[model samples]
Structure formats: structure tokens, C-alpha cells
Target: MNMDNRRYNVNARSLPVSNALHGSSTVISELEPLHRRSDVVLNEQGLPRHSGCTRLKKLVHKSKIRFGTWNVGTLNCKSVEVVGVMIQRKINILCLQETKWRGEEAKDIQGFKLWYTGKVSARNGVGIIIDKEWKRNVVEVSRIGDRIIFLKMIIGRETVNIVSAYAPQVGIEASLKELFWEDLEGLIRHIPQNEKIFIGGDFNGHVGREAGQYARVHGGFGFGELNNEGQTLVDFSLAYDFKIANTCFKKRDEHLITYKSGASRSQIDFLLVRNTDRRLCKNCKVIPGDAVTTQHRVLVLDVCIMSKIQKRRQVVTPRIRWWQLKGEKQDIFKRNLLDKGIWESQGSANIIWEDMAKKIWEVAKVVLGESKGLVREIRSLGGGIIVYRTKSSIRRTVLKPYICVTMRKIGRGTVWLRKKLRELWVKLVLKLLKNFIRTLRRRKESKIFIRLPRVGKENQEI
Candidate 1:
């Protein structure tokens, strides 16, 4: 609900880069690809390490990453100002869905690199735009079947994989619906485990909570289940760890509707971010730049600064140590060789050795009947085979400590599988249970038939 309604005097040439958070610069330096990994194909146009690139300047200088996602309802050749405003948001990225223009025609715009459709008059197509500096070294993967376009942009030093998607309005056609979700899943799977990603656009679905302040908002979390159109999108959002970017719909004074006359427009467009997505800066938003942009206003996002956070190191302490205790009362066999307390107190520059005794312990427990009882250190993490020799003959064995593993896996119940089996059994049992209701109904009908004056035994029986 705390939406900023501040207006900017934006000019095409000298468009002021807004810094929402800080006044000074703290942009992260352009990265040099790790030379150790030769598989990484270097970008020839990558800004030199010391060169102050414009994209990098905006990262720390500007507070918000301005972005807009709109349906652009008007015909291709119409609405110049609307298109300009969409680009003017200086949108770090723009997702324009249902644009009637083709990719070539869409590229004719003064600013913003366009990722558009092949034809000039497509009923539906999506486009992507990046700052001119970003356009030089940006790669894209468009999954046309799902109607989604993914862009890989190295804005300065950050490598962001942004996906712009448009889901088909819900319908009974299984082929279209299935292909949409399947292609999306495949795209997500291909994303590198470490790369940061943002998925945004006109999902045409509601993802609203039933109890939140914005509950009435245009089905925010894809109106969950109530409207089939909203359900698919919401479910996908949930399955993936995506946080809702546009949480607030209308600012305190702004009208409730964003699209229609007298119709409450509670925000439908979204700027979604993954939990692990790299953040350029904290202050970012989807602001309404111009009202005339075909109903859906321009989304203006700003990021004042970007910096890397140093990861904190955690120190782990073991539960027991042999040398820490005084005498034989300490049954622990393993020694704490690396403990700083022991070294500091004794002032001994000595290394405690486990192999000093030159004893080769067999994998089998001689006392136990089971030959597969492998002897291994508790903290050791690995798998291996262990063979043992008996009095009569040598026996082959598996190193898997089956008993210990099963014991450790105990408390965490298998309710996931258990619930599925339970529900299936419940359905079968419920099928048989319906017979009792049928019997009761039959008895009630017979009693009523006999109560009738003209009803006879034959009539009651029938």
C-alpha cells in the first residue's frame, strides 16, 4: 500500500537516472570471466574491467530497475507515446505481450532492443528491451511453443536470466494448456544452478490471497482454483520459489482500476523474482509511468545501487574428543587434533596421528554374526565395499551400513508416500461405503410405497 507516486521529468536524451536509495555511486565492477574454466565462451564486446560502462553506472547510481509489462492492446502502427513510455521507464527489461507488431517493426523504435515476433500483424507476440549498453552482449532463448522468451543479459557485471512469459487464457484444450506448462518447466530446468533469474509479464492469471489486503485485487495469485485461468499460473508460481514482486495494487490516492472504466483494475501485471535471484539493489518497483499506454500503465522500476555481500563462515564443533578428556573415563576413541584450546594450552606443535599404530582394521565386526558389519569412522561420508575372512572361508561383502542408515532415516515419516496410498485406499473404501446409503434409501422408498393407500406388497417390493 506504500506506493510512491513521485513523477519524473523524463527526457529521451537526458532522461534523469533516478536513485531511489542512495545519492552516490557503488556499482559492482565489471567481471572478468574466470580463466580457469575454458568452457566459458567470453563475450568479445564485454566492457573492459576498468571501463565505466553505462549499465554498471545505473546499477549503483539508480535505485530501482525500472521495468514495464503491458498487453499493448492497440494496433501495431498506433500509440507512439504509449510505446515510448514503455521504453522510457528506462526499463532494465520490458515485457510487452499481445503486441500486434512484428520483431522487425518493433525494432524501429528509438530505444530498447526488441525481441519480437516474425510477422507484422500477429494477434499475440512478446518483446524484450534492454538499455543500449546491455543490448551489445545479451543472449536470448525463446520457447515459441509456450509463448515465452528468456533473455540472458550481462548488465555490467551481473548475469541475469530473465524470462518473459504469456500464458494462454484457461481453456479445455489439453494440447495448448499442457504444452504451455511443459515448455516453461523445460526452460526452468535449463537455467544454470547458479545464475540469477527473474520471470515477469502479463500472465493473464490472478494470484491473490483470499485474506490479504489486496484480496479483491485482480486475482493476484491467479485466483486460486476459483478461476481456472488463474489456477495454472498460481500453481506454477508456487512450485517455483518466486516471490510476488507487485504486492500492492493501488496507492493511497490512485484509482482502484488500472485498465477499464469503472472496473477495478487491481494490479494484474507482475515482476516476479526467485528467492536466490541476485539483487542489484533493494529499492525497485513497477511504477505507472503513463496512463495512455493502452490501459495497462508503464511499469517503471528503479535500482539505486548494487553491491556484493560477503558470505559469513560458520565454525562447526564436534560433540566429543578423546584428547580433551583427562583419563580412561573418556570412552571416545577419536582425538580433536585441530582444537585451538588444546594447542594453545599445551603449546605443542605436534600432529596427532591415527595411522601411527599401523593397524589395519577390517570392515567386518568379528564379534557380530553379520559379516557385512563394516567398521567406518562416524563422520566419514562415502561408500565402499568391505570383505571379511571367516575361520572356514573368506566371504565377499557389501560396505553399505544398512542398519545405521535405516535407523537415521526413521523419525522423518514417509507421509508423502503414505498420504498418496491412504487417499487411494480411501477412494476404494468410500466406493463400497455408498452401498449403505443406497440400502437406507431403498428402505425409505418401500415404507412410503406401502403407506400409500393403493400400494400393495408387489408395489412395495418393486
Candidate 2:
């Protein structure tokens, strides 16, 4: 028989690690084929068993960082007891706004680890909440002149950094943009190239590419404030390439909403990071906390999940009796064959072609590889895989774009940095006042409450 041997190419980055590991773990489930293929991955028994990192260790350890950001209708943290309740449930990164506290005042809370960076405005407080385990990644914390405090947290084994910020609303007309960007510019500049950064918090702006109004699953309405920020926020995001993470839709089949206020309600809450880290965002979700005290909603997200792949496999034929086959009715094998083009009707192909199964196996293998290539796309960008149980770069290939940010128009819109940043505090103070007025007008018209589950409700699964 004439043989045509071909070399198979494996892109180091695009290798289906998730699927390969899955296949290895599923050794017992491997089905033997009518024709055998040559490959060392097979075992003495002709069954493919897994080995080491090749065999992905399947696990269900919930490493979810239940994080969210909210404007907190008022400066009253005490009113948002539901937030604390949500924390007890599962909270890793919790950002609050309208905190109305100085940095010293925030220090009094015990047990619960907290970091607060406040602006001169009455309610421009922003901070990051992390479990004791992740808090160690905090390389530095800088206070933004009592207006806002910025924290840079290093993501586990990633070149990407996390920035938690609360921008001031009040500032002078001349240098407003310059002052804010100056503070932000330094944090990103310090991080090494090829490292990504997810700067999320109440920037009070929706700076993302994907477009959709703030939507809530319940009652044909949205949560919080959804007023379009226009280009002010968009321009800044474009200049710096900060992707808004709110593009992911909430799974509210029936009705699930987080916040409500006035005639028009919207979801201003966020759980954002750079869109470049889309791969790292294993499973992003927005969950509401059952809290009655505050007007803002809660957001939940899961990060860092591997992908799934299904590999085409070939093995020797299972236990079969050639003598029994000889005794069987001639039509029996033909009747048992799958009718979905399993066997070619033309091209001189027949049920007794003996090698027909081998041809089918070859087709299936090619089809499987083509299908898997779609699921496994990380190789398109320059990404690498690190060997497990060791700190070594094992495989490298093109993966998706990492966090490579390029900023423009350093002194475009806001106040210039040449002047004192504190002088621009007027802008934030005015913004706080406007927000307070907006809140008062809305509260007078409606009553807000958290969603408490009723036992009699239909199909109520948590």
C-alpha cells in the first residue's frame, strides 16, 4: 500500500491545553476504532491515558473574586447594610462611592480590610476591597490630595495591573483634564511594558466600545443612573484604551434588577477592567445583593478560567469475531451503519470495503482538528504557557493582544497639571452638589427596597 505521511504543525500558544488535559483525564471513556493509528500518546493497552500537566487536573475550587462598584445613592455607608451582608456571602473587590469620609475616618473599621481614597468633594470616596490572600499584591497606594486615593494591585502571575480610582467631580475649567490624567498617567507609566491593567471604579463614565443602555432584567427597566456621558468619558477611554467591562449582559431570564430611582432608572454600577484581559475574565456576571438600605446595586464576576476542547481520537478495533462476521447476514453490518453520510454511496465505495472504517477515521480526525482550531485561538496573539509545578516558560506562541496601552492628548480637555491639583477641587465639589440635588429630587418621588425572596415565588432558584 502507498502511504502519504504529512508533518503536523502545533502552534505553541494555540495548543488545546484545556482539551488535551481533558482527554488525558478521560482515559477510560476513550472508544477504540475499527482501524488503529500510530502515535506514542497511546499506551500498551492501546488506550490513551494522560500524564502530568498534559492531563489537566480537573478541579472545582471556586476562586471567584466577587467584586463590584456602585455609586451608593447617598454618603451613608451605614444604610447599605446589604453590602456588608453581600460581603459575608462572597466579596473580594468592593468599591464604594459617595463615601463622605476622610482617609483617617475610614481606618476605624476592624476585621474587614479596607482602603479609602477620598476627594475634597463631600462624596467622592473610592477604594478597593480584597481578601487577605490578594491584598499582598498591593505594591503601592497614593492619596489623591484627599480627593481620591489610587491603589495599584498586581494580578497573580500576570503582567497586568489593577487600578482602583474615584475621580473628583469638581475642578476649575482650565486644568481639569490635565490634573486627573496626570495622576492616572504616572500609575500606568510605572508598570512594565507587555503588562495589562484593569482600572475599574466609579469613574462615573461609560468608556467602552460596545454600546447598550444600562439594562436590568426586571420590569422592562434598568438600574441606577444611565444618563449618557457623551464623549467626555468616551474621549478619555479612547485616548487611553480603557475598555468598559459592563458590556457583558446579566442573566436575568425573568426579572432581576439591582437599583431603582426616579422616572428613569439605569445601572451606573460597574465591574470593569481592560478589555484586553477578556481571556482572564473566565466568567463575568452581575449579581445583585439583597439589601434594602442603599440605592446602588452589586456586581459579581469570575476570572481566570481555562477553555474546553474535544479532540478526535483513533484506536484499534474493539473485540470482534471475524468468524461471527462471516456467519452474519450480509446486510447486517450495512444496516448498523449510521445513515448520516457515514458511508459514501458512490466513488466505488461499498459496505464490504474492509478499509472503509479507516477512511472514516481519517475524515473525522481532520474535521476534529479543524473544529478545535476555532475554540483554540490564543495562539493568534503572542502569549505563552508556563509549565505547571515549575516557574519555567514551557511553550510560547501568538495569543491575543496583551495590555499594551498608548495614550494621547496629554493636555486636551481638563485642567492643566502646571497648576496645583487641589485648585481643581472646585469641579468635584460642584459635581457632588449636583449629584446630591439629583438624589434628593428622585428620593422624594419613590421608595427603594432590596429584593427579598418569597417562598411561594415560581422557579426561584438562587
Candidate 3:
């Protein structure tokens, strides 16, 4: 085999005097077919594993942040369950309206922290709930009456400002509506231009389906016709160059509607962000099967997070299988160290320790083998559907748009095939879920038994 031999050079000036104590004279050359570093990593089962910094860069450059907005009518007794719903949806930040939480201070609900603003009674109120992971980054909190509350957080290298608001109803006095807008205007003006901001709440308006001249703010995807309240929101968005996140994505009417009761359906709850950051949004749809039990459906916004400072992610070093070093391998390791001329060098105690450590690692790696990479299992669910499950990245369904279009063109045959494929996918997901639950239960039971003995004998049950 044609081989490419490589060698790493060590600095001579840094060498110490103690290296003469323990020594070797072997010259190590990495050969392509022998001891060369392979770009393709393999696991114990001989399967290929993903290596390098590509995955790490993807993880650090863009993070998925989910924002949910819902008008719970009142957060009086359902704070715990509502937080649970947020957790279930994997929401990082939640903005609530009509909370009826009569307080101007922040309160802890379960593990999340809630910052709310309201008057004396349970009337109009707005609140912002931050996930426990990001709560420590909070730098400032602003509570402005019962209609608006703003929070600023230092996330990574960027500053994020979140505002929760509850606008006056459609039939409310014109003066109150005007006052609401005026207050919101002041709040917007006070925010720094360099910081990222997101405002979410029950706006009680619809931007309509026609973009017309408002295409800068609305993406021509909306439910219901435009009303006076909606016109006000659109005008504000146009003036500030902010995009309505819900209107930016094209989804079915079911996903667009945020409030539904009997025959009445409307898109009122909204999430707004700067137009420049609109491209970072992946999906903004209403959660249909929300268990919050409220008139307003939960509007979830999936936005790709960006950090101003680029930090290098730490790579995990594989563990060396030292147990495999026996017989000929152990002799080879000793001989290679002796050949490296480690003892012949003149070095101090610290330098000797460093040289010996390096020589041992290199000799062992060459004598034995480099650590094996992780092997990931690929699952196939009949009908050409495949899924690659791994801890390095989220499990994504493998689908090609071109293939789907081609399948649809084959008439009824394609339709039948698609139906069968969907059925198989569902079944596979359910099976995986069952197995995951079983594993979790086993772990929980094991923990219980382990702690049971630690407790007093009188307190422990059989």
C-alpha cells in the first residue's frame, strides 16, 4: 500500500534535564495503512461514528429557542400545570396575558420564575416566565402597570429583551386603547437598538391575509379579515420594522387560529420580532392539543438562537482500552519507549514527567490501537422511511422533497404507498416511546431500592 508517513516535532528548548533518568530511542512514524489517523471513526460494534467539530459548530452557532404565548384567562390555580405544559412543549420562554396575577414583583412557579404586573383586582395582567436555565441571565425587569412587563437578559454574548403585553378589548373605550398604544410606544423607544427583542401576548387583532403595502411586516399568511385593532398592530409593525412571527409562516387554518370557541375562531395572540431576525424563525404555529384548558390556544414560536461571541466547544476524548494491553502489546510498548531515546535526553523532574507521559501515550496508542468511536444504530420503518438515532444530534426523519413530489405524481398508487408509510412511522414512534418509558421506570425503581436501605429500617417498606 502507498503510505504517507507523518511525524510531530517537539520543542528542544523546553526539554529538561530529568529526561536522562527514564529513556528510550525509538523513532515513531505514522503510516497510512498501519498507525495513521483515520478520519472515519468506528465504535466497538464496527459502525461509523460522527467525529470532528462540524456538529459542535452547528450546536453552538444556532440554538433552538421556543417562545409560547397564551391567555390563560387567569393563572390563579393553574400555575403549576401551565408550567408543566410549557415544559412538555419544550418552551424556553413563555409570555402570558390576562394572567390576573395581582402583583408587580417576580414569583417562582415550580422551577420557573414568573415576573408579572397587574392592578388591585384580577383584571388585565401580563407576565413573562423564563426557563430555569436562562433565568440567571436576567439583568433588568420592568413592570409597567397591568398592560405591559419587560425583561432583559444577557444570553451568552447577546442581550435579549422580552416584553409581554395585553391590549384592551375591541369594544373598550378609545381613550384606554390610545393610552395602551402610547405606553407601548414609549417602551419600544426605550429599548436599545443593539439588543434583540421579542414581544408576545394576546394582541386581540388579525393582520389579514393580504399583504398589500404591509408586506414588510406581514407575509400575506393570516386568518380572518383585518379589523381596527389589527390595523393598529400592522401600522405599529410597519413603523418599527418588526415582523409578525405567526404571519411569516404559511400553515393551515387550524395552525393559524390562536383563539377558538364553538364556531368562533380568530388569530389574536402574536409574537413580534425585528424584521432582520425573521429569517432565524423556523416555525411559529399554534399548539392544537394544548392541555392548558384555555380558550386561547398556545402559540409556539421556534427561533434559532445566535450568540455574538463565538466560543469553541470542548471535544470529548475517548478512553483508552488499557486492559487490552497484554502479552506482545505490553512488550511492544516498552520497546517503543526505549527506542524513543527518552532516557538519553537531559531534563528536570517536571520535564521528565511530561516526556514520560507523552512517550507512554504514544507507545500505547501505536502498540494497542486508538480508541474506537461510537456506533449509532439506524432504524428503517418500511416504505423507504429511515431514521438515524444518535445523541450527537436530534432524531430527524429522513425525507426528500423531490422524492415526495415524484411519489405524488404516480396517482392512486402513490397515495396508497404514502398512507402505508405514515402508518409504519407512527407505529415505530410508539414502540420507541414505550421502550424509553420502560427504561426510565427501571432506573427509577433501581434508585428507589438503593435509597430505601439508606433510610431507617422502621421507615422502609418491604
TM-score, predicted candidate 3 vs. hidden true structure: 0.56
> Using TM-score as the measure, what is the rank order of every candidate, best first?
3, 1, 2
Q: After TM-score superposition, what is the CA distance of residue 184 in candidate 3 from its true location, in Å?
A: 0.7
Please give, for residues 271-355, the per-residue lDDT of candidate 3 as tens digits: 9999988887899999888767647888999988786545444343454557667798788877888999768656798888898
List model 1 lDDT by residue over 176-263, tens digit each.
7777788888888887766667776776666554424333222233222234555565566667756555543332223222343355
TM-score of each: 0.46, 0.45, 0.56
lDDT of each: 0.46, 0.43, 0.71
**Model 3 regions lying over 4 Å from their true place:** 1-60, 308-462
Residue 58 error, candidate 3, Å: 7.5
lDDT of 2 by residue, 194-286 (tens): 666666555544233224431211111223333344235445555555544554544452122334545444444445455455556654445
lDDT of 2 at 262: 50
lDDT at residue 404 of model 1 (Cα atoms): 26
State model 3's lDDT: 0.71
Best by TM-score: 3
**Candidate 2 backbone overlaps, count:** 29
Steric clashes per prediction: 25, 29, 22
